[model samples]
Target: MRIVVLAGGIGGARFLRGLKRAVPDADITVIGNTGDDIHLFGLKVCPDLDTVMYTLGGGIDEEQGWGRADETFHLKEELAAYGVGPDWFGLGDRDFATHIVRTQMLGAGFPLSAVTEALCDRWQPGVRLIPMTDDRVETHVAVTLPDSGSAAGSGERKAVHFQEYWVRLRASVPAEAVVPVGAEQAKPAPGVLEAIAEADVILFPPSNPVVSVGTILAVPGVREAIADAGVPVIGLSPIVGDAPVRGMADKVLAAVGVESTAQAVAEHYGSGLLDGWLVDTVDAGCVERVEAAGIRCRAVPLMMTDTDAAARMAREALTLAEEVRAV
Candidate 1:
């Protein structure tokens, strides 16, 4: 089996780990979201890509779901002591090596896709991981914040980096707009289209629909390529019942005017791109509504409480893909 998955950050990484276990013999290609990649301290940090690589390769901090396990923060502390810091985003000592290597390669004229491939060589993530684009595409969030000068009444609206909004502000403010900066001109990274074209099935994990999967889709040609791939393209809903399974997905969903509901998320993806959609058993009531939207819908337990749970979700997604292919 040849499978292609579009993934981002923690949720995507965990789901991919399960997917790998579910189909150990399958050929897997992970198209990682690069919109969350940030440049800090003159080093390139691909958070989602690193998360997937580390989780699959057994180096991830399982609890936090990002960064390396047994990680130390001496570098971060030293930087803070030196007064050169954005202390909110924690980049550990072990994780810093990844950024160093990536920055070095990028400085030497290697594209991000190539750099990712090189990094994956060490992790051996069990899948061919490609970034969505080699181009620099950063997700930006537009928010209204209290004016720095006038703190009494209303605030000013401004755009901030996704990391700033997520790591610093914690998405407390409503996101007026979610923009994947440079996605309009960004081409699919090397091997991305080929992987999509050859995929037996494609999956969208229960990652953030707005900043994660949504950012990848914002890239030119990627969405169209998936639609034309002729394989069953299915997705597991990040939203369950009335809220997200993890993260502040509801905040970003509202920005895009999509209600925080399983059925609504299915509609947001639309039948044009997605052939099958999976919602948790708690959202069984949405099955008919999702089906009415021309999507093959199923109610299953979508929580990734552990590897076993995630594997079950992967199996369910694959089964639905097979059903779609048959049709």
Candidate 2:
């Protein structure tokens, strides 16, 4: 089967690793979340895309879940010594190579999609990794700054790139609004719509809802394509229990007024788009509520502590999809 997965950063990337192992023979296409792309030090850094690439390419820092393994930070130190630093986000020497290459390619009039494809060629992430759009759709969060913050002119809310809101401020500021600045005009990249149209299954990994998957779906054609894809669309819950597995999902979730719970997340997506939902065994009680919402729901161990566990989670999601089809 051909599977298309909507993904975020580390959590999403790790899930894909297991999904790949679980469905070894399936044709997998990963639609990476590029919302975390930020311009820093004259380089474009796509955190989610890089995480997915590194994790699957077997060059990821296993613990951090992002950047290159066995990385050094001499370049970062030099930049610091030069008094040019946003030292909050750790960009190691080896990892800096990716940002440098991506920035160089982007400056040469290549869209992000093409640059991503070129980078993937070397990583060979074992899947067709496609950007949702070649068009720039940098996700930004509006938040209260520590001092006087100038507004982005998008609206009254002061805006910062997604990464700055996430990595630098650590989501401590109140987010008034989240916007994918250019998604409204974005066109899906080559093979993106086609892959969705031809996909037999689409999986939503445990990613941040409002910013990660939400940002990708915010691209005009992407969400509509999946809703009309005429295939099973399954989702794995990022909100296991009442908290996020990683990242500052709770803060963002609250910004949107959605309770950070499995039930609340499923309801947020709603039956309008999702066809199947999977939760952890601890949340088995919520199965009925999800099913009552007209989407199929099942309970299984949802923690992805290791590859074996993640693969099992993937298998369970696929199994639930089959069950949903049967029903």
Candidate 3:
């Protein structure tokens, strides 16, 4: 199968590992979310891209679900010693080398998609990982600051880098608005729309629907291409048992007025964008409601607790797609 998946950071990367194991012969393409991309210490960091690369490249710390295994903090500690800190997110020495190369290439006038290709040449992430767009789009969260700076949503909106809101504040405060800066003008990166057009199947992994997959669709021609593609487009639920299986998804889900529930999440994407929907067994009761909305719905174990579990989920998705095509 020529499979294309829209993905976020950790969750997306991990799911891809299982996907690879499930369909070793399939040509997999990942359209990764770059909204979390940020400039830190004068280097451009592509968290989702690196996460997917490391995980598939077999260099990832299986337990941490991110960064390299046997990673050291020497570079971080040295930066902290010099009073250069935002020490909240750990950018290891080895991981730092990736950003350094990417930053240099970008500085030399290469767009992010090209720089990412250059980086991928080394890791060979197995699946072809294309960024949502070549444009510089950054996801920003609007948060209120306290008078004493304790924590309060300012009546006036202030935008902070997504990493500051996620890794630093840890999504403690409500996000009034989430914006993908520059998305309005961004064209889909070279191969993005083409991959969608040619793919036999398209998937929305257990990624943050509002940010990760949503940001990718926000780019011009991306959603339209998928909609126009004559193939199965399926989505796996990120919300399980009325809560996110992982991450602060509820906070961001609410920013888009989506209730944190399996049914609501499927409804949020709507029948227009998805051909099939997979919700956890715990949410099977909502299957009828989802099918009523014009999507082929199935209740299954959607959690990716391990590689085997994720592979099972991938098999279920394939089965659903085949069933839909047969009908």
Candidate 4:
């Protein structure tokens, strides 16, 4: 089977690992979220792409689910000692080399897609990984900053990079708005449309909807390509039991005015784009509600507690795809 997955960071990476295990011979193409990409220390950093590559390449830190395994931070420490700021975001020494090479190649006029392919050559992430867009697209969050001198209910509104809100602030404050800067003008990467056009099954993994999968869809022509592909487009809910299984997805979901519920997320994606939706067993009651919206809904175990559990989820997704195809 030809599979195309719209992936974010950790959740997406882990799910890809399971999908590979579930269907070893399937051809998988990963369209990684580049909205999370940022430039730090004058080096370009593609966090989501690197996460997918590292995890699949067997170099990911298993415990944290991101970054390099056996990673050290001597470079970070040195920068800190020199009073170089933004200490909140941790980039290990081993991980720094990747950014260096990517930035160098980019400076040499290589597009991100080519640079990513070159990087993957060393890691060999099993799947063909492509960025959502070659142009820059950074997810930014509009938040209310606390003002001690201001009135109790009022504060200054500021827009910060998604990483700052996610990593530094830990999504402590409510996100008033989430914007994918540059996405409006960004074109899909070279192979993104081709992969979707050729896909037998398309998947939306349990990644953050607003910033990850949603951001990829924000790129021009990408979402339309998938909707018109005439294949099964299935999604597993990241929100389980009215809360995210991992990460602060609820915070961003609220920004988009979507409720933090399995049914709500399925509805957010809508029946037009999604052929099937999977929610955890705890949310079985909402299957009818989702189906009522013209989406085929199935309640199943959605947790990726381990690779085995993730593989089961993958099997369920594929089975749902087959069911959609049969109909």
**Best prediction by lDDT:** 4
Q: On residues 199-260, what C-alpha lDDT tens digit does candidate 4 reach at each position?
A: 99999999999999999999989999999999999999999999999999999999999999
Clashes of each: 0, 0, 3, 0
| TM-score (C-alpha, index-matched) for candidate 2 | 0.95
Error of 2 at 263 (Å): 0.9
State the C-alpha lDDT per candidate: 0.94, 0.88, 0.89, 0.96
Over the stretch 88-191, how does candidate 3's per-residue lDDT look in tens digits?
Answer: 98899899999999999999999888888888999998999889998989898888755565444435458988888889989988887889989899888889
TM-score against native, each model? 0.98, 0.95, 0.96, 0.99
Q: Which window of ten consecutive residues has the lowest lDDT sum in model 1? A: 145-154
Candidate 1 regions off by >4 Å? 148-153
Stretches of candidate 2 exceeding 4 Å from the true structure: 146-157
Query: What tens-digit string does per-residue lDDT give for candidate 1 at 2-87?
Result: 99999999999999989988999999999999998998999999999999999999999999999999999999999999999788
Model 4 quality (TM-score):
0.99
**lDDT of each residue in 115-157, candidate 2, tens digit only:** 9989999999999999888877888888866545644443334
Using TM-score as the measure, the top candidate is 4
Ranking by TM-score: 4, 1, 3, 2
Query: In terms of lDDT, which candidate is stronger, 2 or 4?
Result: 4
